[model samples]
Structure formats: C-alpha cells, structure tokens
Target: MTAVFDTFYADDTLVDHLTKSIQYSIQSGGKRIRPLFLLETLQAFGIPISEAHFKVAAAVELIHTSSLIHDDLPAMDNDDFRRGQLTNHKVYGEAQAILAGDALLLDPYLLLSSADLNASVIVALVAELAYASGSHGMVAGQVLDMDGEQHTLTVDQLKKIHALKTGRMLTFPFVAAGIIAEQDDEIVALLRQLGEAVGQAFQIRDDILDVTATFEEIGKTPGKDVVADKSTYVKLLGLDGAKQALTEYLDIASQMLTEIEHKTQLQGEPILKQIERLRID
Candidate 1:
C-alpha cells in the first residue's frame, strides 16, 4: 500500500508555484483509494505490479486528489480539512488552488504518455481516464451534486448523482483493468458491479457519518449535509433504512465477484476483499 509518488510529482519552472502547491496538497496523505483500485484491479488480473504500477497509481491519485482540492474551494463544497489537513484553497489561496487542480488533471496524462507502456495503450488509457475524471464522470457528478442540494430528490434522482460522483470513479478501475489486462467484457462488468456497490455503500456510510460523526473525529466540519438539508439516504429512507440499503447492495456486489475468484483470486485487495469477505460471512 506504500507507493512512492515522487516521479509523478516534479519541478517545472513555468508552473513552479502551482506545482509546489499541488505537491504540498498531495503530500498530505489521503486514502489513495482510486489508484489502489486501479493497481489492485490490474493485479487482480494477474499483472505483477512494479514501478510502473506505482507510477500509474500516483497519476490516478493525483487526479483524484486534485479534484478534491478544487471541490473544497469557496465556490464548491467550501470547507477546511481535506486528507486530514488544510484543504488546498484554504492553504494556497483560491487562485493557486485552481491552477494546481488544473495542473494535476493535465499532468497525469503527460506522465502516462511518457511511461514505458505501449503507446496506444497509454494514449487510450489517458483519454479514458481524462474522460472519466472530467466532464463525463466526476466533474459531471459534482455539478449534479451541487444541483441536488438545491432541491429535494427522489431515489432515482439520488441514484443518478451517486452513479456519477461516487460510482463512476469506483467503476473506473474495472474498465482500466480490462484495458491493461486485455480482459473480457464479462469480467469487467462484474468488477464494475462490485466497484459500484462498494462506492454506493461508501456513500451511504458517508451519509451515516454526516449524521453521526463529529467535526473532530471525521476531520472536517460535521453535518454539512444536514446544513444543506440535502436529500440523502438518511433524509429519504431514515437511518436504519439507509444502512439496510447499503448492506443489501453490498451483498449483491459480493455475489458478483463469485464469478471471478476461480480465476483472478482478487480477494487480496482490501476493498474487494472486505466486501466479499463480509458477504461470505
């Protein structure tokens, strides 16, 4: 789980300030979930991870973390703590945080393009990653999330927001793994299901936390969702019902992985293993 991020982070005279800011922001040590998913997904397909895996992992994490930086700005989610430290906008000023986020988004492909992977593979992965992290996925999800808070939403409406904000990024590794491993679509689909369920459950946990956790324990201001009066699972179905939904979908996701264990033995990955292990028990 300890991956070095040095190579993907570098010095550029032109973007010096932004680079420093982004690097500082990344150095704060976030969960590294997306990159872990990408790495583990590749490993799940029997790819022996090496320096290249670390490189790709860093690139993915940088993209994800950069999004968080922009996401927490005054115009966005607007809070203080991120990755358990001062958020980029709070520490670097809003403008620098913006440029840092832009740099982080573009720099990953630049790094990936320069990597030792097959040219076409790198290009396609870069393009797909950009699309998923950009307008078609995470960015779109954020816009919808903002809009979601502005009004009440039905279950379908909330699900759409989760599919983008939480699910797409989670599903990303499944597709990226297939691309890198040359896997069949069927396996990729199963993995996507697992990823989405993991994300949905994770989002539900977040909602539960919003109601239950404190500003100190959770490392950020608590009850922002309550403040927003946003229609969360808690607001929609009640807390017990929300937890049950998380459990039910997570169980369904666990069942999906049974089709793959005979091959990949992917049960070693923490997130995947945790879900599957829970289901089996």
Candidate 2:
C-alpha cells in the first residue's frame, strides 16, 4: 500500500511542495482500518488480493485522510495534533492544509479510474465512492454532527449521523467486495448491513475512548467531545451503556457475516476476526 502511494506521488507532474505536504499527512500513521476492512472483505469473498485491489483500497484511505485533514482545521475540530503529531494546518499553514485535503479527495477518482479493472467495474466503484463521500453520505453526516452539537440528540439521531459519516465509507468496502466478487444484490445488501454495524460499533468505541483514553492512547487530545458539548454514545448512554451498545452492534455484525457465508458459501472468517478485534474488553 505504501508502495502504491510512493509510486503515485513519485510522478514529477505534481507540484513538489503540495505533494510533500500531502505525503506528510498520508505518512502520518493511522490505524488503516478502512483499507484493511476493504481487503478483508475482498478476501472473505474469495477474491484474491491484487495490485488493482490495493489501488481501490488506497483510494478509500485517501478519502479518509482527506476527511481527517479537513476535520482538524480551525473551522472543524481545530485540533493541534493527530496521531501524536501536529496537524497539517498547524504545520503547513491552513491554506496549504486545505489544499492538501482537497487534493487527497480529488486524487481518489483518478486512482479509481486508472485501476486495472473493467470499465463497468471502475464506473461502479467511482459512482458509489462519490455517493459515499458526497452530500448524500459523509458530508451530510458532518453537517448533522455540527448541528447536533448545539442541541442534545436522541440515540437514533446520533446513529443516523454516524451511519452516513462513518458507516458509508466503511460500507463501501463491502460494496466493492461484492462488485469485485460478482455477488448479487442480496449479498451486496447483506455486506452493507454488516459494514454499517461495524461502523457504528467503531464510532461507539471512539466515543468511549474519548473519555477513558489518555493522549498517548488515542494520539490526540482527549475529552474534546465533552469540551465541545457534542452528543456521543458515551454522553447519551453512560460509559457502560456505550460499551453495551458496542457489543450489540458487533453481535449484529457477526450475524451478518454468518448470513453472508450461508448465502454465498464464501469464508467470512477474515471479516469476523475484524469484528472480534473491535471489542474493547
């Protein structure tokens, strides 16, 4: 994956300074869970991972990185550190950071278009990704989150926010896996459900960590959710309640994996393992 990124940025056509800034953000360590999920889904579907698969996975990571960069800006979370390093806006200046985020967002389409896949497959990947990342998905969710900050929200409303913001991107991997594996709509729908369950669980865990984790554990300032007066599972439900919710979501995810395998006869162990790893305790 890093090799793919290195090769893409190695092109001399890109501006040196801009590329460097983008690289700095990308190279900053992250859990890389999104791409790993995509790969695991593909593997679970009996699709052999290839360079083409890596290209698609990298595109997902690029979009995620872009979101993180923008999420850290003064207008957003306004954080100084991510993954235990100064944020792009803090290190490269706000203007450059914005540009860097924009580039990361835009580059994914180029990566997808150039991937070694059929024209129809490429088109499908592009369209779904655009939807997942655009107004109907993450952006709309972000708007809801920012708006929710001003008012206490119901648990359902909070789930609605994250189902788009975080879940759509996570769900895209399953979509891509289904498409690549040539699965039918039924299987695709099942995978989407599984991904959404995992995404919600992941967000709940994040909310739990915000209060329970230290800076070294989370690689950023903790308790920002409380400081910002944001609605989170931990705030709405107590910490114990949030944890219970995480377990419930993960159970739903496990069931989805079971259904997927029963229907497709494909091994879902890889994805099941991922769900198990999400457990905090």
Candidate 3:
C-alpha cells in the first residue's frame, strides 16, 4: 500500500500539477485501522468478503484518511505535522490542501456505491459513514474537542467528547461490517460495543502517546492535547489509572464478542487481538 501510494504520488509525469500536489499529501502513511476493524469484524461473523465488501472497505479507509487530512490543517488543529510528516497544508499550500481533503471526502461514496453491493447495504453504509464523518460523528467530536480547550470536563463529558469525535467514526466500520455480513442482531450489537471500547482504548493510547511519545515516534506533533488543554483520561486520572481503565474496557469488549458462541474462529481475529493489546497499556 505504501509503495503504491508513493508511486501514485510520483505519477507527475502524466497528471496535472494540481492533481499531483494533492495526491502527494493525500497518499501519506496511515494505519488503515478502519478497514482492518471492519475486516476482522466480518471475519468474526464467519463471513468472507465479496467484491462488494472490498469496495466498501476501501471507502471506509478513504473517509478515515479524509478526516486526518482536515484534522491536520492549520485552521482545524493548527497542526504542522501528520502521519509523522508535514501536514498537507504545510507542503501542498492551503488551496491545494483544501481541494485534496474535499476530494477525498467526496470520492469514497462514489467508490463504495459504484460496485455490486446490495442497494440496501450500500445505502446503510453511506448513511453510517455520513453520520460518522459529519456533524454527528467525527466532525461533532472535533467541535467538542475545540470547545473543550481551556475547560475542565468531567470524565463522562470527556468520554462524550471522544465518543462523538473519535469513537463513532471508529465504530462505524464495525456496524457497517455487521450490516454487510447480515449478522444476527445480537452479534451486531456485540460489534458495536466492541468498536466503542476499541475507539476509547485507541484514544486513550493516543493520549498516552501525546505525553510519553516523541515527535518522531508519532510522526505528528505530540503534546498538542496538552497545549489545547482538552480533557483526557490521562488528565483526570493518572497514567496508571488510565491504564487500569483501558484494561477494564478491553475486558468488557472481549466478553461482548462471546455472543457468537462456539465460533472458535473469532479467537484469532485481529480486532480481538487489538483488544488484548489495548489491555496491555
């Protein structure tokens, strides 16, 4: 993926300069966690990816990337760095960055709905993605985070902040996968819980990284949360207490996955592995 991205970015020999500029920043490093979570959730449900799932999964990744691009902008987070490199706006110029981010945001739906997935599944996924990426989901969370600056919030309030900002979008893939796989209601519910827990753990880990991680390790500006003065579990609770909370969430998430009984296949699912790792710290 990284190599393809690099080559894709370097394809300036044929494309227009503006396109090249946007592609350069848009094709930067990312963990691809959203697709991975969706894939694992589908696997846990004993479903194989059809051609349609792949398209939708790719859409999931595109949306996640789009959010990161906007999040790194000077106006949004005033961030100079992202994915361990200069932000899109830093290298591409503000105008090109805006276009690139907008292109990514708008492009994925065409990609997802373009293929052979059932109309119902596509519609549901689109609605889920829209909510997650829009005012109710990731964008909502960002607004809360921005509003939270310089203000102390209760732990519940902080969770609410991240649940909308970070958790909902992260959880979207799981819900989307459940819909794609046509899982039972109980199983879908389990995936939802697992995803929320995963999002919370991921955010807490990010909070830890902000304080304990180096700028090089994170590839983006560290300690921005501190500068922003956004409330975090690490702020309300000590590092050790935050770690404890992560463990509890991970355990809760793992137990929720037991709904698909005798489904021994889920034992090695990557999402489950992620939950165990989250428990580690």
| Number of backbone collisions per candidate | 0, 0, 2
For each candidate, the alpha-carbon lDDT, in order, equals 0.74, 0.91, 0.75
Please list the Cα RMSD from the true structure of every candidate, rounded to 1 decimal place: 2.7, 0.9, 3.1
What's the CA error at residue 7 for candidate 1, in Å?
A: 2.4
Worst 10 residues of 1 by lDDT: 272-281
Please give, for residues 1-281, the per-residue lDDT of candidate 3 as tens digits.
34333443465464475566556654665677877777777776678766667667777676677777788877878898887788878887887777777877776787776758789888888998898888888888888888888899899998988788889878888888878877667766767777788788778888888888888888988888888887888898978888887777777777766654344345435667766765543
The TM-scores of all predictions, comma-separated, are 0.90, 0.98, 0.88
Order the numbered candidates by TM-score, best leading: 2, 1, 3
Q: Write the per-residue lDDT of candidate 2 for residues 19-118, one digit (tens) a residue.
A: 9999998999999988898888888777789999999999999999999999899898889999999999998999999999999999999988888999
Q: Considering lDDT, where higher is better, how would the candidates rank from best to worst?
A: 2, 3, 1
Q: Which segments of model 1 are wrong by more than 4 Å?
A: 1-4, 12-14, 262-271, 276-281
- The sequence of per-residue lDDT tens digits that candidate 1 reaches over residues 53-161 is 6666777777787778888898888888875678888877999999989888887777776667777777767876877788887889889999888588998888878
Best by lDDT: 2
